[model samples]
Target: MAAEMSLVSVVLFIATGALVFFLLFLFAKRQIMRFALRSARKPHINIGADAPRELREEIQRRLTIVQSVRFEPTLLSEQVLEASKSVPNHYLHRMKALDAFTNAVDCLRSKDTTIGLRGTKQTMQLYLFTLCPSAANSSQAQIIDMFCSSYNHARHHPANFGNAELTNYMELLDKVIRMIKDNKKRRAAALYPAVETEVRLRRDCGKRESAETVRHTGKSNNLRLQARRNQPAASRPEHVEQFNMVDKSSGYSSTDHSSSGRGSVERLISPQHSFKPERDEAV
Candidate 1:
């Protein structure tokens, strides 16, 4: 009986050992799976369409603000007729555009020029290049170049910044803000076609007023000349009638200097001096 109990004890010990080993194996497997999941998994961030409504609206508003800002008389305007010469209408870079737009508005409104100034400076360079071909000579371009040099040195040679003073690029920031504001105003004005029409009407009215003034002045001068010639009042009408006559007179006949003075004055405004923005280039 003692031998039988000993065998049973051995069997029971082996079974308990097996159970413990199985439990240990399962625990180890669970631990390994947990580790793998933690290492391989990444936190998901909802963005774009998946982002919240408020976040989307804010982003849209910022984008619209930047889009409203325009650089007039740009290379785009000069070659507007040719599709081949067209520059794609878009911001310089996406991330940079967002940062700069936000910073510029903050800088102007809240006077916050702490962060995002670097991005703003770079955006200005893009703006200059797009708006004007002679961007290299612009004051903003010079400032940005200096900023780039300092930034590179500080980034690559950190030891050199120990005694170096932190450069203030707020002036360039100011320039960026100013340009954006000016552009916004210009674009806003352009939105109202009535404003342009009113301006044209005013210009036409001024031209008519000036012409009437010139005409009255010429009439008075002609009367003075007739009076000087001691012509009778009846003959004055004849002289006035002659002045009013068209160039349909005899061949190569000299025009009356006083009467034709308006045409001469008008001719002084040469076509060469007028603005002609069209360019000659095509595929």
Candidate 2:
């Protein structure tokens, strides 16, 4: 009876151990599945499209305020063409001087003078200043002419900018006129026989290209023109016009300086001052 009782105790201990082992296995399995699910789950994301309307509008208002406070012309394109021509970023500052010039009409014609008008007018005073024309852009004078026209309009259709905005504008215009005239005249004075006020445009063109480029450019131009002199005279009237200096005595004779001036530019560019010597390159 003692032996049987001892054997029963041993059997009961084994059964309890097995049950504990089974429970531990189930717990481990449950933990592993939870970990896997967490690993597979996508991360939570909150996109603007899913945002409330009020939040979106507040965000947009902040953007507008930031843009209005543009300390620089960051909104404009980087002007890759100018950059490629070795123009400097420093030249961009001159655009501020031209700002009022570009937006002369809008500055003179403040649409809503009663609300945010000072900011509007001040902004307009130099509106186009951010796009300072290159020296090659001969139309800088034309822009000033536009400003003068706007000034006339303001004179006739007068509105009050109580803080002397109009008065300030006139003063600024006078200053700009004097500054441009003085600077151009000073530049002209340095050259032989002085120079004409009409031809001197006080534009902020960048530094000169390297001397090698200038020398090669001259040689290339002479060679190219000599080649153009060789093409059959009347193959194209435009080409004939280009060589007015050389083709006038030839078959293509027409007294139209206007067509020659414009067409000559097109022809020159199309050739790049370096036309290939072969017919294939021309083709």
Best by TM-score: 1
Q: How well does each candidate superpose onto the true structure, as a TM-score? A: 0.22, 0.18
Residue 14, model 2: Cα distance from true site in angstroms:
0.7
Off by over 4 Å in 2: 42-283
Over 4 Å off in model 1, which ranges? Answer: 1-28, 40-107, 110-174, 186-283
TM-score of 2: 0.18
lDDT for each residue of candidate 2 in 96-211, tens digit (9 for 90 to 100): 22333333323323432211223433533232221122211233433443444444444333442222333333333533333333333322332224222322233345754433
What's model 2's overall lDDT? 0.37
**lDDT for residue 144 in candidate 1, whole number 0-100:** 38
Quote the lDDT for 281 in model 1: 31
Q: On residues 206-267, what C-alpha lDDT tens digit does candidate 1 reach at each position?
A: 46532222111111112322242364435322212221232322222122245442332122
Error of 2 at 40 (Å): 1.2
Q: Please, what is the whole-model Cα lDDT of each candidate in the order they appear?
A: 0.38, 0.37
